[model samples]
Target chain A: MTRCRFWRLDRHPEGNTDFARFLSLQEEDCAPLADGEVRIATEWLSMDAGTRMWMSPRTDGYQPPLPLGSKMVGLVLGRVIESADAGYPVGALVRGFGQWADVATVVPALTGLEVVDETVADPRQHFGALGMNAWTAYVGVKEVASVKPGEWLVVSAAAGATGSLACQVGRNLGAKVVGIAGGADKCRYLTEEVGVDMAIDYRNEDVDARLAEVPGGVNAFFDNVGGPILDAVLGNMAHYGRVAVCGMVAGYDTDAPMPGPAKFDQVLMRRLRIEGFFIPDFLHRGAEFMPQLREWLDAGKLAVRFDETAGLENVLTAYERMLTGKNIGKVVVKL
Target chain B: MTRCRFWRLDRHPEGNTDFARFLSLQEEDCAPLADGEVRIATEWLSMDAGTRMWMSPRTDGYQPPLPLGSKMVGLVLGRVIESADAGYPVGALVRGFGQWADVATVVPALTGLEVVDETVADPRQHFGALGMNAWTAYVGVKEVASVKPGEWLVVSAAAGATGSLACQVGRNLGAKVVGIAGGADKCRYLTEEVGVDMAIDYRNEDVDARLAEVPGGVNAFFDNVGGPILDAVLGNMAHYGRVAVCGMVAGYDTDAPMPGPAKFDQVLMRRLRIEGFFIPDFLHRGAEFMPQLREWLDAGKLAVRFDETAGLENVLTAYERMLTGKNIGKVVVKL
Candidate 1:
């Protein structure tokens, strides 16, 4: 038996990801790998808004309530310590779905773990650039939206993990990219560092006014933060524009019921399409998405950034920081 | 010269479509029809929520307001008094893009005047069943939402022009149509007369409770009145549900600034697709839709209803009744 530490959602956080609500460290016995099972010691965990809705009561509480005293569900990088599964050899570095914990057990029934090499670049990018965030940005813009070169693209939270990747990827594909973030610093990072054509700090800038600068109008909008930002984007979308419903971190802790100014009118007026997707929804496309993303990263066509916190105890802090928009890139917890 | 009465957005109404505010009505000289021209003696006009949007001032105040004294745009039926265009001859009755006046002249380039026989069914249905309302309802459900037979289909404002048509069309297409209307009277008209599978008088019934009764959950939701009804539907939508954004009557009057609770999360959680569409946007399909609709009506497979108001001067009264939900089915002004 080996000691394994984990973090789980405590009660339901009211507004921000409540780090103080995290449970104290607990011990768990590592069971021997069962037939067709693999045992892994988690090295890194990715924190993002994609999993936020699963925590809400409205999601039919499908995902097990982040068990009161267990690690939260997230993506993690681990090394296979033991394997009863023939395909997964012991000592191979792999990534799979797990909690903010030090170790995870897996089987083929679940999405199989993929081995990644850290020496090539930062191993953490495997949890980011080559992982779900980048894949979401890639598949959403390229596949779901079927974005064409020369199309005008707008991305919300452009300084964040998925948005930054999407903007850079859109630019690489010959599409012009506009980024919207929270502050001047993040906006500057997006245009100057992430290589976006333009960046809008929504906090100070008017989205509609800035949109006019795009000439005709945005052909596609990759949204990460919903609410007013989504509304603004809808108002300026060109006829036949496509909107990929990325995330709605803006109203995560909101208790007030959302009312109707339901913007369906705009959707009709502009003949818009709003498609909601989670990376898992496109799991079947992994065979294609992974190889393509790997090439983009290896060729240095994509930029990767990550904010990592050491130890499982710091998981909740990382989550809080993410919700507060304190991190500029992907927020990950290192176990 | 012919006397014609037309309603303009005198000053966009605050809460209701005020007839007095419908700024213009006058006797105008008619020009002799040239090649490819058809002069129509207008007989019927339909009222809808879309007209309100065109009537109001743009928030940015950029585009000219739907020119203050121009004829309102809507579906209209008329008898051709003369035609220089070989396609339509004198005494031919048809329906097309006309106005609230007693007479209208249209160029062949823009006319979609479908010849109809009133003895077979009321010609008024040409503007209801085979007109913009029915076609809009059919396309919104069958095409954009891609509703499947045996799936749950819910429609808001289930008693109005488009709503009633959608309900019947959903039922005819093998869907269990659940309509959401404002009062018991409309609800009765929907289920008892219109053949909707079920009815929800949102004014008295609990939508969530009623939704729970429809065991299959909602596979497709054809939304007409957005806001709380839409929010409630979001929480109960089945996986891969499609929400057809037809109209949002809920937000037409409130003076509040337009920030609403974004159910953008709903789209992702259920893998939903919420698409908005304007009928004209799909005008290219009119060639196919109109013929198919006429065939359906001629075969007695579909039915249409209307609340008819006689006289062009009553246009304002008709518009008010439609806005207040006082009229069932299509509200048409007759000359």
Candidate 2:
């Protein structure tokens, strides 16, 4: 029997550390797959706040619960060693929904799993800067927010994978970008490295008052952190502002009820637009983003930062660390 | 000097009241229009809930306080018996911003004052069904919400002027329209008269559970009343649903906080779009809406309900009654 480690919901996550406990899977002993199935060896894993809500029972019956003993759900970069499906071949490096384990089998319906090109400078970039995180940031800022040149684009969790990419995308579109991060170091990296016009360490200064510095106030806000920050930003937004609700990183771990009676009152009185978007919602536009992002990268207008963790053994720890805002950019686990 | 009576917010309305307070404006003794002004005798007056928010401090700081001992701000129909402006002719029956008073002098800039064609059915219909309330309802549902054919559209304050017009507009667009109202009488009018697909008396029925009857779930929700009912309707929304934030009649008198939390979690997960709009935001789109609405009106596909009150003396009472959902359809005071 082949032994593989897996992360499962620990019946209950007591606190931050509960992100630590995951079960081991004996893959060779599990039930056999039906006709169209493929087995993979997971190389890299992506961690996000959305995964936490999926594990929780409080999701209003919208999300299915993570079965007590089943492997946790996540996106991963892996190689297909075996296949019952003709489309995906052995030795292909593909990315898709996979168990947190090193090896897993998936059906054809779970096929967002696409083979990666070996010619790229770094294969991991396909799962990070040029991947789902960056693509989501790009589409939401450009399409949903409809941000125009010279407008102020404010983003929270601004040094993280999606947030940093969003700030860069905003700048490339000629918008004045303001980033909100947790500490001084992250804020510096966002403004100096990512080329954001301004940076706010939300842990220190007041977000709403500092927004007055933008003069005309924010035109579009790409939010990765939601809670008091969302409430504060909504109050200072300009009339007819657009807010792209991207992630709720701030509210995930709190024992307290979600920190909002979010001032949606401002939403009406100011005639603002707040839209929520998931990356997969715009997957059809994936090809469109690739060429444009490639152009920016080729011109050195795009800069990517990776918080690289070596080996799959530290994957769970890296995920926990990512959630606590320890990583500066894309959190990537290297094989 | 002729005495003109009006209602003052003597105090910010703590709760819905009869709105008892004396406000008077004296008739001008010398009223030849000075260069670019017009002197007019006011005939009809309109009192709306929009005046409520402007009472405290301007929420957007765009409008100023209605000064003590001054006339209340509203729209009125009047005859320009005297005109100093070359553009505005004498004896012109114009509709524009005026006081709750019987007469006033106004400049061209403060006036959208249009010359009325008296041959039309119910000149007040121009101010009611075809006026700001109806126009707002039209633009919000058509432009902002973008209600398409066969989509489920639900509206709050379903028997009010805007609500009634929105139901017709939704129907004209081939949408299945649902309305939520306070009483059975309003619900009956919404279905039997305004011709909605379904009507929910929020006071009597379980709003969330009954919405399951709509099958596909509401695709668009035109919210006039902002309170618990909005919270209830939110649960029954489909993915990618649109919410047009028009008014907050339910919380017009609310001084303290209500129980509804910010629904960002559901919003993000469902990929919903929530937008607040002022009618003027789409003034540029009137060239698009007017011809189509006129076509619908001429084809008899659209209908309107008007609650016409007579005399300026009843304006304050009518306005207060509107806040409490007392009137059905467009609440207007005819000359």
Candidate 3:
């Protein structure tokens, strides 16, 4: 029997910091695979802000809260070590919602487990440009927000995984992209590295004043951090603007409900369309999006800067980094 | 020179109750029509809540603020007394955005002036089943909200003009209709006269609790009153539901911007769409919508219960009654 290390949720989180107090790392003998289950030797773990809501006890989240004492679940990338499912052959490169363990087990269908293309140079791109984050960006910018060529597309949390990809997606589609990030460093990365048209350092600059300079107002907004940032964008949108609510990272830290954008009435005032979307709900359409993403990757039109943390022991650190807006790009734990 | 009795906006109104303090009923000598202008012998005025925003100094509204001292603008139904434009000939029954006056002058093209069908037994139907309100309900329920057959549709301000028409439109589309109103009498009217499947009296009843009883949650919402009522519906919407934001009467009474719905985060949780639409924006499509509305009216399938107020002097009383939710249906001032 193989020994596996995993994090277990002991209690709901209170704040962004001190996540370890509620989760404990434990070692146990790996259980025999049940029918239709596959085991992965976890090589990498993607740290996502949306998972914070799963740790919360709030029933109003996208999905039900993870019960206490359960192994912490997340998107994992690795080779399939063992399989009870014929589709997931052993040694196949796979990615899905699996445990934060060295040996992660998952129900093939439930965890959205799929074998990824191995031809790509860096397999980590499966969790980057070719990942769910990229899919979210593609769907939000192109389909939901309906960004037209030559339109002004504004992205909140633009230094993060999804927003960065959203900016690129908007640019590829011929939209003028404006990115809003928390720090000067992140803003610099967005403008210099990601090559966005404009980057607003939200923490250091007047976001409202900066956005006001965009002629004809923002045509589409891909919002990852909702709260006051959402309010700022709402007030600056053009008539008939579309807002794609991708994630509300601003409210994920607490159990208390997030106060909505104060300027929400602007929806009517400006004839705006605000639509909220969660990526997991759209997972089945991955095959439909991958070819274009794979092309973007091959052409160097799409790229992601990885903020990698070594070892499973630092999973909480990476999570906190992503949650606290300290990471400039996709934060992931390498086991 | 012909004389006219018009309501002038002396000052921006501070509240819904004291309209008399800001607006005065004044007598004016009718000015000569400009080259493209048309004048109407105003017979009746449509008291729409959306007009309240024009009386406010808020520059951020759908249109620029109406200048103080301007004649209060509203939908006028009457015969064209004179016209420099060929489309609106003398003695032609018409409806357009004109003044709240006995003799309303308008620039034909700007006000969306159209010669109405005078053959209908009740000419008031131009301000009723065949009116802009009907067009609003048709477009909002069918196009914006996209209420489908067998889906559950909820309409707020169910006893008012657009709301009542929305309820009927939803019903006509084979939807299970739910109406939310302020009073028991209105609730009764919604269920009995409008024939809605469910009626929620928001003023006295537990709205959230009642909505929880809806099987599979509300699929579409036509919100005329936005405030706490919007929050209640947002919390109870089904996954992938649509909300057509038609009006914000709750905020229209005051100059202050309305606080957003507290449960707006539910938009993400449920993957919902909230879109705002102004009726005037869709005015050009009236000809495309009128045939179906006229058919519905002639078939007796669509009817508007009129809350008629007599005389121009009682316009303030009628306006206050409609604004305060004292009227059961379409409130019109018979000039």
Q: Identify the candidate with maximal TM-score.
A: 3
Candidate 2 per-residue lDDT, tens place, B36-155, comes to 777677877766676666554444532565655555677777888778776779888787776676665678666566666566566776666556776788877987888999999999
Clashing pairs in 3: none
lDDT of 3 at A243: 99
Off by over 4 Å in 1: A8-10, A32-36, A52-64, A115-122, A254-265, A309-317, A333-335, B2-9, B21-25, B31-37, B59-64, B84-89, B108-121, B253-264
RMSD of each: 3.2, 2.6, 1.0
Give the poorly placed runs of model 2, Cα more than 4 Å off. Answer: A1-3, A12-15, A21-33, A59-62, A254-261, B1-12, B22-32, B58-62, B254-262, B282-288
DockQ of each: 0.39, 0.51, 0.86
- True-vs-predicted CA distance for residue B31, candidate 1, Å: 4.9
Candidate 1 lDDT tens digits, A239-320: 7788887776776665443433345456656777888777766545665677777888888878777777887767778877
Q: C-alpha displacement of A281 in model 2, angstroms?
A: 2.1
Ranking by lDDT: 3, 1, 2
Q: List the residue pairs that clash in candidate 2.
A: B161-B329
Q: Pick the candidate with the highest DockQ.
A: 3
Please write out the lDDT profile of model 3 over residues A1-335, one tens digit for every residue. 97999999999989999999999999999989899999999999999888888999999889999999999999999999889999999999999999888889999899899899899888889889999999999999999999999999999999999989999999999999999998889988999888899999889999999999999999999999899999999999999999999999888887877987899889999999999999897788888999999998899998799999999999999999999999988999999
In the range B1-335, model 1's lDDT, one tens digit per residue, is 55555655556657775558545666566666677878788878877776666666655211244676677766678888888877777888877776667777777566455666556458777777777788888898898878888898999988988888888788878898899998989988887888888899889989888888887678998887777888888878887788888876776664333444245466765677888777655545665677777777887766667799998878878888988889898898888
Model 2 CAPRI quality: medium
Of 2 and 3, the candidate ahead on DockQ is 3
